[model samples]
Target: MIKAVFFDFYYTLCVWGQSLEPRLRKITERYGFEVDPERYVKARENLYAEASGSDPTTHSLLGTMQEIIGSYCEFIKGLGVQEHVEQIAWELLQSEHSLFAASAATLYDDAIPTLEHLRDAGFKLAIVSNWDTPLDPLTERLGIAHYFDIIVASHDERVKSAKPDPHIFNYTLAKVGVSAEAVVHVGDTYEADIVGARNAGIRSIKIDREG
Candidate 1:
């Protein structure tokens, strides 16, 4: 019997109001750089894939921030904007911080209902996300924080590892006071959430709302 349900944040329970492309475009424009949005998006995806595949536990918050800035600079350089790479990177980072810090995510239509059902059913609930920022306050602003007993993020001080790595899952299990056998994880990312939970010896369900 499953005593707890762990959920992924982005694309599983909630999604960002604005994706990276538009934000990137906005920043580039502010800096007088003309970029191909498609190219920029592809570059970001490639960089993110590489970063996400690595062991996040090896990097601290500052290290991660530096990595992001470097990735942005690489993309900007690819767009022929060689000047002000560091400045642009810093401004872009600040923009991102301000944006997400404002809690610009919206819950799915079924998210609240499902979470409420599970909570009412006496199942312990938690949010396990790979998000770099603090998740508790964002969930709180989304009006669903109270439904979760634990909110764990990859960037959390206690969780230095991201999904697809068992460390984050292990930390969550410890915090939730449940064995992996007693919990089920639901997420949209197969490699991250599904494999991560499996690696942690927990059952998992993949949810692809689009497909």
Candidate 2:
């Protein structure tokens, strides 16, 4: 029997608002980068996909920030905007980070209700996310923090490893006081969430909301 349940954060429990594009545009303009909105979005998507597969523990927050800045610089350079690429990338990073830190992502319609039901059913709930930002504040802001027994973020000192590395999952399992065989994880990403959970010897469910 599954005694504990773990969930992924972004795209699984909550989604970014429609203002994401406008916010991106604002940041790009503020940084003096002449980027086509559509192309920028596609580039971001591709970069994110590539990043998700790699191990996040290899870089500290500062290192990751620098890496992101470099990626953005290269992306803009490819777009024929070569001057001040580094400065503009740094500005864009700061602006996007602030935007995300503020109010941007909203909880899914079924998120709260499902969590409530799971908690009521006596299952220990936790959030295991491969995220750099703290999950506590975001979950609290979303009003779903109470339902979770723990929130494990990959960037945290306790678990520097991201999903698919198994370190984060092992940490979460230990914190939840549940054996891997007794827990079930649900997430959207196949490579990160599903593979990570499996590597930790935990069962997993992939929730494909769009499909």
Q: Which candidate is the best by lDDT?
A: 1
Candidate 1 error regions (>4 Å): 18-48, 54-62, 69-101
**lDDT tens digits, residue span 1-211, model 2:** 8999999987688876533355556666776765675676566556555556655567777777666676767666655566777766665555444233447667778998899899999999999987766778888888999998899988788787888889889998889999999999999877788888999999999997544
What C-alpha root-mean-square deviation, in Å, does candidate 2 show against the real structure?
4.3
lDDT of 2: 0.76
Clashes (N, CA, C under 3 Å) per candidate: 0, 0
What's the TM-score of every candidate structure? Answer: 0.70, 0.73
Worst 10 residues of 1 by lDDT: 95-104
Span of 10 residues, lowest total lDDT, candidate 2: 93-102
Model 1 per-residue lDDT tens digits across residues 25-122: 78778888777766775666565555456554567767766666777677667666778888876766565542324555677899999999999999
Cα misplacement distance, residue 79 of candidate 1 (Å): 13
Give the alpha-carbon lDDT of every model.
0.78, 0.76
